[model samples]
Target: MNAPYADPSVTAKTVSARISPIGGLDVLSRNEVARLRGASGSGLHALLRRCALAVLTSGNISDDPRAILEQYPDFDIQVLQQDRGMKIELSNAPAQAFVDGQIIRGINELLVAVVRDIVYVSTQLEQIGFDLDASAALTQSVFEILRNARILKPQVDPNLVVCWGGHSISREEYDYTKLVGYQLGLRGLDICTGCGPGAMKGPMKGATISHAKQRRRHNRYIGITEPGIIAAESPNPIVNHLVIMPDIEKRLEAFVRLGHGIIVFPGGVGTAEEILYLLGILLHPDNASTPFPLIFTGPRQSAAYFEQIDRFLRLSLGDEVARHYQIVVDNPETVARMMIKGLEKVRHNRLDTKDAFFFNWALQIPLEFQQPFRPTHEAMRALQIYHERPRHELAADLRRAFSGIVAGNVKEEGIQAIEQHGPFAIDGDADIMRALDKLLQAFVDQHRMKLPGGTAYVPCYRVLSA
Candidate 1:
């Protein structure tokens, strides 16, 4: 049940209650429960608290990583062990997550997901000694996580389309995403995204309506995210299947490995990071024959946005990079149709290669792409962005550059670092730096750097052009 905020110290509405696991997790061992309840330095409680709070406060529209925590300081969650399995107790939880004293079913499921992933990653992966440092093992880790979550369906066809875009976007751009999603859903295609608001939510929202109209049953709206990103951008309501990977690298790998194709919407640095990450993988000599479909689309009014992205990409990765993706403007049906055709190619390729429909085992991802990038000030400054390097390698560093900016902009650790030390200093080739500056400046001008309700966006990085 919901309750009024009685504590003068606390400002947001809250409710205190005990909720049982709905779906995501059913039971936990005594040892697992102890780790979850442990509040010490090595314990999982802090991580659980952050992720669970994000799930409880889902649909909150704030990019500030600490907004929810600050607003509800008293909020706490604990996994209570019982002979009947386990029960979750919440103290001063978000009131919006409940209705008439019962937790919102969807929020409960997501909350359970937060716990499940935290426990699984801590107990299973780490205990199993998965060599996260190696590329193949990292891929195996991702596969195991997805399989544990029961997201990888064996009988399904190659119809999952991974949509990459920003949570901060224009109204028109957001609407365009919905339209494209509706078209995709009508054609029996599902969607997977970062699971935040704006572009992430729009596609899933549109797909729901179309799925209902077509009487589509068991349609999947998968949202894959990591701990750092989830803290800033909470999962949207439309996501029925939520999987929180260990980090952003695993999250990105989850997208490419699980989905059949990808669609890019107009977005800021985070979206750029995704684009470069994918293009880097596709550009690899080993993956040239892989038939992964990638398309960039937006409203007619936002054509210039995609044009800027196209220019920056060509300038940074060379014109040959354009062969990996197509830019389709203002046409939702065409995007869906093209995506359908692309999935056909993916299906045929998988059949010939004898690969599983749920996971793209045939695609080769480099170790550089799999490794976790800390995005520290030193790391950002040390990136080699000159044209002297191989194009794929250059793309990897470029992706890291944008990732650091994203961390500084919304992630708690990145923001703290940026506040303690000034903006990250990024210097590369003169031409690349200039283009990067122009693209970032355009993002700032368009108010695509952060959500509108937050404080004005101060750039988190400086482009040092030669």
Candidate 2:
């Protein structure tokens, strides 16, 4: 499955022009522009370049983040302050981002998002003294990021569906996601996702047809991603609203907090990490009764994929962990129907509990889940994954383990770490380790871990039996 348009000879084309901001971002202070253009270590230029490139090359199929940079090595972006507003200038940008010498409207909007989030997180959060390390403080940061992006609508009902799945997935699985999205869209539900391709793109693609058919105005297709993973899994073209969180932890928190419900399609380690993250939070005593609908679904061919996932979850987290989620096989209509009913319950529960519909204020995410887990060699080995700890706590560690694997698999930093330090070693209870090893092996065997036509995926971590 080589990218249909891949050609090393297709060198990047340089474009230098000033473009006005779209949406709410119209102005930036001179200090902000300096920070964006600053070459110092603290500058936002590098971050801006990576994210802007990702949005410009929205439909790129490569999982290697470095590939894009290498292809467009001369690419650069800068923020220019003007009397009326701010303008963004691109150098050596991808030609695909434009049509007839003008940038596409969607790409322009996404580019603005790239600048907005980077500036806000770097300046406002730091200046306001937000404690990103504390759990409550971190959740507040996530909320503020979403609110600033105008993603949190006060009057909107609980209709935002967060779709999670692998960027690399079978065509059948992708099609199945579109079907589910169609059904969800027909019911007037908006979509949110990690904002990559495959399953993430499927539902949005499906929903657009339904949205058009229903003549639905102002439909939202939101995409949330972090800096580390965004380059590898670039934003899909359909995402109308895009927000880049500072890190993976905050990105995951943003999804669960902002989305009314979650629909998981077939995915690899990253998807497993997401499932564990949510289940960990839901299993916490405070969230036990919360009505957050969780569904794992795919086409009939993907039944075994979910089965393996179910087995792994039950084995490591215990059988009761199954109670938190439902599995729907090959039934797009039922999946959508069930989600509508689930969202209805969520709406009622929010009303009863006095929680905000746009954000799940009542869900309690422990500090362990919110704190960033840097996958250094020592940190990966120190994770406590035994039966003695609380179920939710163990789930957090398990989630971290998968998160590290995801980093090693596709993320640029993770790949560099593996290249320099070797594979990460994950140690846990013997039975749990074995189950984890088996599950990961399945992902590798099925080619779920990398792009469909890429070279063989080398293991990035080892599971040690206790």
Candidate 3:
């Protein structure tokens, strides 16, 4: 069947269908179902529609969240509460998610995930039943969210390798991520990512091939994302287990708590934000004894990008921070071997501390890293990024700065804010300002700030001369 309505602006075919629950998302409370079917205002229904559309349109190349919405303006979703279970109704949905009038099973499961996460977070979490004050409470909230999604495995060992990188990247960089992931998979490791395209998808794709070669069953390909990012960077098709966190801060924390190790690839400000957040948490004296493997690797041609990143880290956080990470360029096997060795260390540490293997209960994440950072104009201007503050504290604020830039580049609300008020104004110590400006300019020059297509890139934040 053809699309119900044609928009000259978007010629892509669309379809409408009703799908039953997949992966046990059929069970929902009546109140939850009502909220999902609420009026199309700022209620839970609106969030459900946006997230469900994002799942239906997985693998879309555009980074602008509004771009997809504009392409299929009439797309909508509704949840029907039945006597036995639930049903999802899609109107003007992306045709890509369907094959021969039937929704792809994986897409169906992800669509159910969209409904499950949105309803649970909006209804249960927003009611403040989970205390958000102390650091312990925040961490518990993250654990509960993952548990509700059925992601945390108590019996599993620490072998989930979280891959972090930008969705917008060069072909070489993306292929390199796959190579690293292939090596990791051959070593019997699972994969986790932000669940978007580019680097996030490459690793999982490579692992699928490797897992097939090894005849590995039940290989987990997990994708963790938040509402703000899913529409722009929809879950990559390779993700078998998808979890949508409440916010970016919780999403980042989830990555740290669940994964045994992390591999960084060529990326833009979002990747930078993740690195800063991780390093900041590790820098705390309480977490210094923990064993978390971190490796930065890319194609040989992308070595220069790592060099600049290493320089920025050294300058901003001091040379001692270098002790925490290893940079291995163009060596996927070596990266995997090092990860294996590091996981051994982590296993030993967990055993020594009597900590759970599934979650990093021993790692100390300060409140600075747990709290959400909204990238408002005022928040951006007020950040203090100088040497006067403790190194970890400074890293936390710097992570927020990069996070704001990420919001401006892709998220819908941030994009609109950038249009209303010019680029965010960021002024700090002169040395740090220069470093930040140089790093951001490199991203723009390399087409890392946005996907490589359509219009020219625009600066989202200004680095003033301090």
Best by lDDT: 1
Question: Candidate 3: TM-score?
Answer: 0.96
Candidate 2 per-residue lDDT, tens place, 144-216, comes to 9999999999988899999999988988998999999999999999999999999889999999999999999
Per residue, candidate 3 scores C-alpha lDDT tens digits across 175-276 of 989998999999999999999999999999999999999999999999999989998999989999999998999999999999999999999999999999
Candidate 3 clashing pairs?
none
TM-score of each prediction: 0.97, 0.96, 0.96
Q: What's the lDDT for candidate 2?
A: 0.90
What are the lDDT figures for the candidates, one per model? 0.91, 0.90, 0.89
Inter-residue clash pairs, candidate 2: none
Which run of 10 residues does model 1 get worst, by summed lDDT?
Answer: 1-10
Backbone clash pairs in model 1 (N, Cα, C under 3 Å; residues 3+ apart or in different chains), count: 1
Error of 1 at 234 (Å): 0.6
Q: Which of 1 and 3 is the better model by TM-score?
A: 1
Candidate 2 accuracy as TM-score = 0.96
